[model samples]
Target chain A: MKAKILYIEDNEQNLYLVTFILEKHGYEVCAATDGQEGIDMAARILPDLILLDIQLPRMDGYAVARHLRTNPNLATVPIVAVTSYAMAGDRDKALEAGCSGYIEKPINPDTFIQQVEQSLTKQEE
Target chain B: MIACLVKACMPPNITHLMGFFISLIRSASAYPFRNLSLFVVLILLCFEVPPARAEVRTVTVGVYENAPKVFTSETGKPSGIFIDIIEHIAKSERWKLRYVSGTWSEGLDRLAKGEIDLMPDVAYTADREKIFLFHKIPVLTVWSQVYARKGSRIQSILDLNGKRVAALDKTIQLETFTRLTNSFGLKIILVPVPDYKTEFTMIASGKADAGLTNRLYGLMYARKSGLEDTPVMFDPAPFYFAAGKNVSGKLPEIIDRHLSEMKINPQSVYYAAMKRWTSEEVQFKLPLWLQMLGLGLGVALVMSLAGGLILKYQVNARTGELKLINQEMEQRIDERTQALQVTNSKLQVALENLAVAKEHAEAADRMKSAFLATMSHELRTPLNSIIGFTGILLQGLGGAINEEQAKQLKMVKNSANHLLSLISDILDISKIESGQLSVFFESFNLKDSIFKVVQSVRPLAENKGLFLSVEVADDVEEFTGDVRRVEQILLNLLSNAVKFTQKGGVRVKCQRNAGNYVTSVTDSGIGINGKDIGGLFEPFHQIDTGLSRNYEGTGLGLSISKKLVELMDGTLQVDSSPGKGSTFTFTLPNVIDSV
Candidate 1:
């Protein structure tokens, strides 16, 4: 079965761009526009990997990562931090806040699909 | 008859003696010579009769006072060594003694005016010598001395410089002290104390530095007061009794003889009187120390009451001072408190104004974001149509058009492309303000991405008839960074160079900038003015907006480029001068090395 990917992003255009790249790689994509909904959707769908945006409404990507880590059912799921904040130490902050991997936003169509596949495969192993 | 008369003139006793003497001479010379001898004897006897006795003349002696040596004293009456000698002369030469009594000045004045015959015990000073015939006898030697403070340094008349010496009002000692002190150039303040005792007290109490008194008086005072002897005596001149210049002729002779005789008696009455007066045998009994202590305590109690009154005044003064200080402190506190309240109110007003400003800022932000979304959709839709249709047409989808028509179509396509870029820049700025813009990162070949940017802008450079060159430095084969943002920054710079320059070439260079790769685009274009360089990266800031009208793009390119560079953790810098072209550079960290 194709690996299920959950994408959390607030910007509609960015979400369209990311989903277009992920679907083209034969991955089933579930999108949540907010961080809390992303965590709830991740639990329900039991996605193989979650691509979470750091800046979102109501809940942020770090909070979602922490929420997913706390739930026994979703504890093992791999979460990737996707953000536009490319300042120094952002990656370490994301990782320290419970994301397994980090990605910058404005998705590169080819590279986005490859990175998501790599994260999902690594989770399975 | 002559012989009988001669015999009658002589006494019967003499005639009998003469007859016996005649019988003796007649026996020798015979009867003839015997008659002549008897006649000569009778003649010598008549001439030898004794003269009748004259009565004794009585000389009158007068004296004002029984002067010790010159007058005698008997039972407190005037009878002394002087009187005894004077009575002996009076008995020998027959003189009467007359006694008188008066004050010393009165007696001296009477003697000087010739009212009295003589005055004894007078010192014959030069002034007194002018009016009096003085006897040579100096019956007593009185020395002048200065009785000073105990352990005083004063020793002689010269040492009396700048010192206050006290003396009696009118006495022989006063004249002597003044004359001697004046001769020595000493400043003597002759204080007339009541007596010698008081004068000693003046010196001891420091009222006077020293006292000028007779040596005898000073010694007597010192002995009586039990004071230390600070005798400063010198220049012993003699004291003698003076008689009037026109006295009774024998009066001076009588005084002279009396004085001469009195000198023979060594223990004279004057010495006895002085010894009696100055004797230490009659000591005065003083009150006991306990009695003096009691009197001192009484005085101290009176002084303590006065001290208590002064202390009350001091306490009142201190209380007044403290009250003044407290009032001043309160005034200062009030002023500071008022100032603080005013500052607090001003801050409150400032905070309220800041809140209002923040609300407006947020609203403006929301409106900008909404407008950006609508504008983005509107602009991109038309741009897509234009670019899509032009692509088809240029690809010969409508059958090959003429070169002129194709060139025109391409021009239209470029204009549409520029408009789309302008709209995109605006949208990006709005998105950045609303915090919706995001950066994308990927592992990519840095050289490949730079080459692609050069290739894309090369067409425009060719269209502008300007040479465009890309020189990638050695050892920079691959780097991990955001390719899309770097491409955008490079394209904006290159496009501006192409748009502004009429002829000169444009060059793109990449070099290592510390830990980052610095990419610069230098253009020999119609260069930006030096003054406008700072505004170059601000949105809607164009040099001469009217000149920018000829250029077909909104002035948001550099601003959007700067924002995009910042989002990728880089710096965008520009260097330019008026008419000297421009260099736009930016730094991008090599992603692999950055981590």
Candidate 2:
């Protein structure tokens, strides 16, 4: 079975690139253009992993992350933050807000799928 | 006949005797038988008549008031010791004396002019001997004695200093007192009265401090007028009977003769006269204790006066010293005040400059941080898409691509990746400079991080046909530090090694030196000159400064890596020489606290 990933990002190009990369890797990709839609869609579809962008429109990725953590159904789901907010404590901030992993932006396409798989695998543990 | 003539020129007393005898004879002729013996005796006594009686000489005497000596008595008679002696001699000589009373000076002038035959009570000096004739004998010995009002301070000759003294004018007392005081270097004011009586009057009236009078007069009259005799006495000489030079030398000789005879007799008229006049002198004596008390009081007064003078001198000296000290202290205070004011102004200027510098530095840091934030997010967001899409095209996920197209796509992906690294390096250096960069401390396997960095840089080294290698010691196992930053520093060093090496190879070695990890990256392509290596770690500095620069880089990697290592309390150093390979080593303590 194909593991599903919910990609929450405001940049359409970033969403498209990530979707294409994950779909090519034989994983089903779901899209949410904003943090709230991502959180709502994440709860409805119950995706295998959530790839969150820290800087998002409407509800921010950290708030969405914290909100998703409160729901028992989405709480066990892996939430991975893929962000360009890479200065100093951004990774710790994402983790503190209930992210399972943090990946710096301008992600290397070759390693992007591996990182997503790692978060899903972590959730499985 | 001559015998009868001589007998007829005899004295009247003898002629009167003859007259009685002749009358008796005439009476006997009338009664001859009754008076016959008396007529015979009268005729015999006529031959014994004395020669003509000596002529009675008249002497004019000058008298002045000098009591107990020669002064006019209240009975209008010339009386005193001199008068009594002169009168007795006059009686024996059968001489008539004519008294002329006047002031002492007037009498002296009368005697000088020979208008008076004699002047009494004159003190003899060699100067007076030139003008008047003095008897060989002085009638009395006298000295000038000082008299003052009762309870006056004048007690001795020296005590007459600065006093106003009254003395008789044209007298031996005034002339001799002036001489005596001149010799003693004492100054006194002389009030010359006409007589001793006036001198006593002036002193009594408080016009003079003391008076000079002969002792005979002072002793006899000083007490009568409430004047006391002072112990100051000088110029003791005999008081003589002064005669006019033109007077018969016989008169003084006769006076001298009588005085000499009278002096020896002791019971003579001279003694009788002196006793009569000076007998009024009081003979009172003070008790012994009273005299001693007066002496003690005198000594005390003298000591106190000396002490007062000494104290005044010392006070004046101390006052002068105090004034000098006060002036010096004021000057020192003024100097200290000036120095303090200068220092205060300098400190104020320094504080102001420091405040301004701090303000400028803070503002610059704020701007840098803002730029770093913008570049980190805004630039990388677009870069994420470019690198991702280009990567997708190269992989042929959409459709199969020809070799040429695939090659172009690969180039496109490489260019994008390079651009991303440039942007990332700029953001990193900016964050470090602005002090916004921070490290996270986590336990990570040291060998794992080194291998990952080596794997990522291996592809680039292979593309350049350069060998890549890594050697981490067995002891360089799991350690505590910022895992991300450690990986970043190793990747930066490895990438630099791969980029600079043309052939040969690049090597990475990690070892545990005591408690620290020493990681070194050595490259065999082109080595840097020793001089150029010094500036190699400086930001934006590259060894290639030529028009045709060979290297493609932002020249920020090594500088950023050096700064990152230093942030974790580590040191990065480079060893290289021209035409030889370069080795870059870094030492980081295994346990660094993350910020």
Candidate 3:
């Protein structure tokens, strides 16, 4: 079965690019426009992996991470935080709030899929 | 026996005794001790029995048994201390002397009654002066002191606190002892004796536990009276001879005359008598051997100590000069060292502050890099899709783009690549400023790197319709340096050459000079003015502010290229003639090999 991924991103272009690429790689993708929608969709879908965007409207990625961690249904879902704001300590912040993996944006079309797979593998281990 | 005398002599506190008797009668069982005390008081009131008087003379003198001063001596002659003093006065004045012995109180009574002409050894008090004429000067010094029988337990004044303590009647000691015991809250029996001699005798015979007498007589006549040494001495009294106030006599004048004479003339009989009685105290003649030893040791000790002190003084004076000089030099050294330490600490603080400033600058530089990266990413994220999708369309992946659409897609791709290059230049400058741009050096073909750079820049020149060429010296091919940065330098110059030139050509030439490979780029375009040439190598500066919109750039190419050349241990320079031509030149050192 194709690994389903939930991408919680506020930017439409970023979401389109990520979703199009992820779909091209044969993974079922569910997109959310904001952090709350992402958390809501994540609980319902129970996707295999979640690509949480740190810069989001209404709620940020860490908040989404903690909310996702609370739901028993999404306990096994691996969260990978994607951030475009390249400040210091952004990765540690995302990881501290229950993100199993971290990736920086603008995401490389070449390695984004492999990085997601690797984070999924890491969560499995 | 002594306790009974003690009770008898103490003028019993009649009121306290009455209270005790009342309490005793109430008890009705303690009548024995009460009757005994009553009997003792009666005996003390009536027991004293005698009266004695003397005949008259030129100066009838009354002498009390004040022992050692006016007492019956061992020979029983009419002699005592005052008698001898009077004999000296009588001899001087050609007057006959008369002396008599009596108790102190009896003598005072007789003198007051004008029976005696003068009484000696009387302590002058304000109360006594009303009855007698006291002399201004004292004849002798006396002490009221406690004396005890040989081997008796009454050895000290405190021991006589509850014992019978005898003091001469009408003496200073009597009043003193009364006040002292009252002040001390001592329930002691104080006996008023007629004289010190009898007081001493009573103590010696154990009729009294302890009695006070003149300290000198207690010491002088102690062994004779079978008593031990005086234990407590107090209230030093000055005794003066007093004349009867009732008699208007020349006695005071005569007495003062002889007393003053005796004081001035040590050879007088008074001095002889004092010397005779107090001979035991005269130890002016020490043993001969001890005197000799003391003199020898004293002289030797003083001489050696003086010699040592003089030598030490001379040595200290000699060393003090050297010490002063050394102290001055050492002070100068210490001052200089302190100044140097201050400067060193200041420099250390400056260094620490510089390190902090450097850290802050580095942080700003990092932010700039991140800014550039984000800008590059943001600028490229759109470009990524534009260029990638365009490339895809041009490749006919979008199901056959027509030739016109393909041309537009290609143009879009090229613009995006240009934008990417500009972003990279900004990133590179940020890296150099932040000290993050690392150089990798290796032995590589210098000509090949330049050739590749030229080939890559050929399209920009061709697009501008400017001819570009490369020239290389055969010996300057292989060089040890960061070949990539060298190529980047060459590319920046070549691109600038093509970008600026409108109707002319660009050329690159390489040659070897002094272990360095020099590269130069020449352009025949709208050249920079000499004034503008200096600023041309600075990032984001342009000479053509004419609004002609002629050349396009972020103006970072030359600055980035200049820094890259410097990073490879090279120099970048330019020479330009306005509106005519320009040439950019740089050199990369061929790093030497240690192996």
Candidate 4:
């Protein structure tokens, strides 16, 4: 079965861009507009993988990752942080906060797909 | 005959002799015998005479203890200038001599009463002349003077006004003192001391303003007591020895012959004796050897010191002359050194100019490569779009699609327009580097320009779901400058902010700073690392090589902003930290007044 993905992002353009790339690759995608909703949706769907945007209204991506990690049912789910912050050490910070992978924005379509596939495969292992 | 008479009165043996003697007398007598006998008896009686009364001769001598001319010696011997003269006259005259030692009053008394033969030293006052006859020879002239304490304020007779004075009683000084006191209205305190020592001590102890005495005696007292000499205020009064009126008949011959002779021979027996008795002889001796030695050494030492001082002065003059020459040479060297330093600095400045030019040339070479790369990419984008759309059309991929197919084709036309904008940015940066881009300055509201920038970047921020806030500080009022360029700089910064900031917010602030209007764009987004800050404003220099592939840009925004700010006579500055945020600020001159 194809991996089920949960995408949490507040920016509509970025959400569209990420969903388009993932759906085109034959993955089932679920979306939330903010971090709180993302946390709620993840609990409900218990997706195979989760894609989180660091910058979110109401709640942030780091909070969502921590929430998913605490739930026993979704504890082992692979979470990828996607952000426009390309500063040094941003990826390490995201990973340290319980993300499986980090994707920098002005997103490269090809790299974004590759990283998402890799994070999903890592989860299987 | 008396002897015959006695014989007649005698016995019979003598009577027979007497009768025979009577008959001899009758035979020789045409003269009476009795008368002859009586005449003989008378001759005998006259020759037998009564004893003579002694001669009553008196000698007068004056005594005044304080007088220098006539004073009693320390040994109680009567000796002075006048004493000597009187002793000589007494010896020459062979008269009976007597000395009446008493006060001056007593001497005057005896001379007036004719009890004394002479007064040794008395000035002939009118009242005195009426009672006594003076000798032709004046014994001495004595100046009467005032004696005051050392450092006393009594410099002149005028200083004696209303001041107390002391004088010896029954002295000529007393008369003179009285007259001066009355004339000057001085309060004379006549202290009749027994001697000059008492009088001098009284003045020294501040008991009197001054004491009146003969000038000679005052000087003698000062010398004896080691007090300083003071001048006499009044004229000198001449004094003399005087004889009594009873002996006035012999005065002229005695005074003329004897006194005049003594005056001629002043250094004779009398004067020598007086000086010896008065101890004036001691003053004529030579000073002791120790005192002479001390004085000679002092003089020789002073002469040697003066010679040494002169030699030092000559050496100092020579040293000063050499120092002046050295200073002149040093000043010349200093001037030459300063000139050489100026030339060295000029050479350094020229070298720095060359180095800066080389850096710019290298930067231009990189920019040319970046520009060519951007140009090829920009041209290929539209060409690829156009070629794809045209190939699709040629293949009838949109066959019979009607209005929908044509509308979709117009979207490709919009994508082509976006590629044109990328080419435009490259061309603009090249124009800026070549010095071909110029700003058109005009008066405009600075806040309005900043608002335009915020509005232009707002859609992009919204697309990322990021809050965009614009704040104009109250101090930033309307200003005049190059509005279009200012807007362009602000737009570039806000665009960069929206591009990086995927969350949180982008803020544009406008404020007045110093003399300029400042605009700042802050983003809570992907911040530039500190290591990259230095190269942020260099054209075509981004933080990482792969940044261009991840984020879309020519990497010329900050360099363009900085150059544009400088052209407006402003400064562009950036502060950023990795993973935190970045703030970009630029200033424009406030040209409101000119507007």
- Counting clashing residue pairs in each candidate, in order, gives 8, 1, 0, 0
Where model 4 places Cα greater than 4 Å from the true spot, the runs are A20-26, A107-115, B1-80, B83-277, B283-295, B301-595
In order, what is each prediction's RMSD in angstroms? 29.2, 22.8, 22.3, 32.3
The best candidate in terms of lDDT: 2
User: What value of lDDT does candidate 1 attain over all alpha carbons?
Assistant: 0.70
In angstroms, give how far residue B430 of model 1 lies from its true place. 2.9
> Over 4 Å off in model 3, which ranges?
A1-125, B1-364, B367-382, B395-403, B442-449, B474-483, B530-535, B543-549, B591-595
Best by DockQ: 2
- The native-contact fraction of candidate 3 is 0.02
lDDT of 1 by residue, B1-595 (tens): 5545655766553443443343344444456576676657656755674433223433333343323333333464655333454455455444454556555566677777877665655666777879987777665676676777667776556777787877655567777677777787777666776555567777777888877665655555565554555546765666655677787555665456555544555684434554544454445665789768877997898789789878889988999999999999999999999999999999999999999899998888898788776767656654545664565556565478999989988887777766767676777777776877667677887888888888988987897788988888886767776677778888888888888888888999998866799999998877877778878888777789787778867788888889888888889998887677889898888777877
Per-residue CA lDDT of candidate 3, range B1-595, in tens? 5334544644433222332233334433446787667655644543342222111237778876765677766676656677777777665554566776778788888999988888887888899889889767678887777778877765455666678776776677778877777887777777667767777778877778777777777767776777776557788989888899966547777677668756877887778988776555422456889989999999999999999999999989979988999999999999999999999999999999999999998888778887776775577566556654555556564477778887887787778777767766776777667676767777898888888888888887888788888899998766888766787788878887887788879988998887777889999977876677768778777666662377777778888888888887789988888778789999777887322
Which portions of model 1 show Cα errors greater than 4 Å?
A: A1-125, B1-298, B382-412, B432-438, B511-515, B575-580
lDDT at A100, model 1:
87
Candidate 3: Cα lDDT at B56:
26
CAPRI classification of candidate 2: medium
DockQ of prediction 4: 0.01
Model 3 lDDT tens row, A1-125: 88989999877777777787777678999999998888889988889999998877778888999999999998878999887543434666887899988886555554677898898788779
